[model samples]
Target chain A: MSHFTETEIAYMQEQKLGRLATVDAKGNPHVVPVGFRYNSELDTIDVGGYNMGKSKKFRDAGRHGRAAFVIDDVLLPSQPRGIEIRGRSEAIQQGGKEILQNENVDAEFIRITPTHIISWGIDTHPYHPSSRKISS
Target chain B: MSHFTETEIAYMQEQKLGRLATVDAKGNPHVVPVGFRYNSELDTIDVGGYNMGKSKKFRDAGRHGRAAFVIDDVLLPSQPRGIEIRGRSEAIQQGGKEILQNENVDAEFIRITPTHIISWGIDTHPYHPSSRKISS
Candidate 1:
């Protein structure tokens, strides 16, 4: 079974960019906006960017094994909405092209296996629980 | 002198939202999209949200004193642009109304004093340095 609910999947599909946060060995945090996709087969969030292998975030993910990814945008006139995914991340080489599907893109990527998720303002049911802890 | 350059200040003025990354006591990373503005007087990035004081991010900032804030947007079709600021953070009370100008907003906010900055695609001069470490 997919870790993402249908509404969450739909929200991810509509978004094109997410901010990925990783902590370096020194315990300093870093954040950057990147292209990401929901990998159905792996049930993970895959992030790809230019020169992914050389990026600080990639190294941080490999060293720390923890990451947080957020996709959010404000609706007109002050309504903010988005999702926050916090979980385990793996830095993988030769996997970026599969997610990005661009010939010139790098083959390295960061895959996130979500252990917790918090979302708001995108659900059809207004009173639904907005935060969840995933056991997978 | 301001930590932000003229170009960086201008770019920040054009954007309203930023993603803030903070680390918990357990060394886990958390990120969330936030409403932020460049506080000219304080020379800091001020983040405000609903129930700000009760949010985990607020507590995280209070505990860690370190945070990373990134303001970025894709210029459509594939051009990504943004500025990332990493530095000291303080969770302040009764400051949200000052930055947000909303009476209904909680009186809590996070203030960031940037010690490092990185920017790309937002500068008028292409050959200019894209990253800097501030001594302030």
Candidate 2:
């Protein structure tokens, strides 16, 4: 069974960009916009970038092994909707091509196995968020 | 002089939402989509939301006193442009109404005083990022 609900998966599919947050060695959080995809086979959120191997976020994910990813957008005038995934992250080499599929993409990426999820304005009421924990 | 360049400030003014990343007591990172504005007077990033006082992100900002914020969007075909601000953060009370100007807004908010900044595709070449540190 997939860890994500149908509505969550659909929402992820509709979005092309997300903000990835990783913690540095000093515990300061860093966030940047990146290209991401939902890997149904692994049930993970895979993040890829142009030069992923040398990126600070890639290094941070490798060192800390944890991250938070958010995909959100406004609907029409004022409706805000999105998903937040906090999970175990792994910086993997030679996987960027598979995830991003861009000719200029590097061969490195970050994979997040979600442990907690909070989503709003998709499957539930616009302002009411639904959260759950996935026990590994 | 302002910490943000004119181009950066203009870009911020054009956007109404950003993703805020905050660290918890356990060093776990949490990110959520939020409504934010560039405060010219204090030269800070002020984040406001509905029921802001009780949100986990508000509490996280209070406990960690550090955060990362990102505002990004894709332009037509494929250009991605945005700014990332990492710095000291504070959870403030009785200020949300002034910041958000919404009747439903709570009287609490998070304020970020930027210490580091990274921006791409705004003033510089597309995909080429410029970064700097702000000395207090």
Candidate 3:
């Protein structure tokens, strides 16, 4: 059984857009917003759009064996709640029709199987500065 | 000279965090939030945490050479102002005592070099959704 409550997974799936974090060749963190689809049945998340081998981010994923997918914003800064999942990537082709086409990528799917689930929604910050510091 | 404006870089640094787009081994898109540092002098961005290397998000970065980083939120359905950077990642280690104590990152640094920087601010959003779809 999964550790995540159905409500938690639902909350994530409901929000279609999230940020994908990757590593550069130099070990720097690179981030970008993207659209994703979570396969509730398979307990997997699907993400794609960049070319299989040519894209820089795709290449990084192949090199690095881990990554994080995050969603949600902290409105009050003091009360920051969000979802993050860690998983490995495996390239694949899906669908006969293309949804959104970018010159760099024609792949239909990139799936992630999460190992950890972190939720920081509770009031853990004692002050705004501390919360603000972590939120940014 | 860099194509990004001073204001843009400042905005990026101030936020200090972004959405990370990485491709999983399965060709799925993985999005996550990451804390980052931008060095204007070298025109590079760095991201790493003690346990970050173990995260799924990082694994995806190694898989996909092309990744995007986006800052700013979708306040209104129609107005989305953020910067998406296309780049590559190479792992580099700057061994130091401080790296071991603070970040737990024995390597000390990871860097990303940008090929294209896409700045989409309030000026670019058109009929975009106000709510962000969350995922894991």
Candidate 4:
């Protein structure tokens, strides 16, 4: 069961930006800002505005066909809640009018269908707000 | 040749944390927070505190090794500089002493060997810092 349901996906769609991470051939990690859209019907997410081989990172994704996306800090540290979506890539043309339709982006689009969805809340004993007094 | 150098790697390692992106089985994108350390000698980076199989997303990494790590919110936006490490993950167990030493964490460690490295920045054409300037 996922902590985030269709309702949660709709809520996150409002905040379109998140941190994206990918690795090049040398095992180094590359991260950047990306704009995303949640397709509630497909239960899928699409990310647009990526340039072709703009960096080795994107090139690696083109070559390897996998990447990770994270959205954090929106939830409190003690009760951090976020989503992780993992998937492969298929490169389409970057000049299409459909790609440019997104008001929040500047590059082409890549759609992701998560095979595994991991969503968790910090339920650690100490950080529970009810367990700790804020003012004191 | 890449723009990121040893000094920048050192600077990034000293920072508290970074965002990491990984792929799920269905080629969906997942992003999360990852605290990592850079190994200068082998030119590799290490990320601990992430568990595979224990969580669905991390388990997805086992099936697909592709990933991206990002650290941002620096002084610059268009030309923001960050280090990206990309590679595979090797699961290993360290002694209790090595695992329990971190001030805030208590768990095993996972080593990620990056195969590629890159330095990323943006063009400043549209990012005019003075655009919002007010006449005093």
lDDT of 4 by residue, B53-107 (tens): 2544356455576565655554544344455555565534452124324545424
The CA lDDT of each predicted structure is 0.87, 0.92, 0.57, 0.52
Model 4 spans > 4 angstroms off: A1-7, A19-32, A40-43, A50-68, A74-78, A87-107, A122-136, B1-6, B20-31, B40-43, B50-68, B74-79, B95-107, B122-136
lDDT tens readout by residue for model 3, A19-133: 6666655554556566676666666666665343455556666666566677666656434556766667554555302433334445555566776666555332311111121
Report the number of the highest-lDDT candidate: 2
Per-candidate DockQ values are: 0.89, 0.90, 0.24, 0.31
Calculate the i-RMS of every candidate, to one decimal place.
0.5, 0.5, 6.3, 4.3
TM-score of each: 0.94, 0.97, 0.52, 0.59
Error of 2 at B40 (Å): 0.5
DockQ of 3: 0.24
Q: How far is candidate 1 from the true structure (C-alpha RMSD, Å)?
A: 2.0
Of the candidates numbered 1 and 4, which has the greater DockQ value?
1
State in Å the error of residue A32, model 1. Answer: 0.5
Evaluated with DockQ, which candidate comes out highest? Answer: 2
Say which candidate scores most in TM-score. Answer: 2
Worst lDDT 10-window in candidate 1 chain B: B120-129
lDDT of 1 by residue, B50-105 (tens): 78899999999978999999998777665667899999999998769878877766
Per-residue CA lDDT of candidate 4, range A1-136, in tens?
3324654565566665666555556544456766666655555566666443254445766666766666544454544656555555544436322543555444555555555545444232222211221120
Model 1 C-alpha lDDT per residue in residues A22-85, reported as the tens digit of each score: 9989888999888899988888999997778888999999889999999887777756778889
Q: Please write out the lDDT profile of model 2 over residues B10-97, one tens digit for every residue.
A: 9999998899999998999999888898999989999998888999999999999999999988898878899999999999998888
Per-residue C-alpha lDDT of model 3 across residues B53-135, encoded as one tens digit per residue: 55655666655555566776655553556776667754444532243234444343345577766665633442231222112
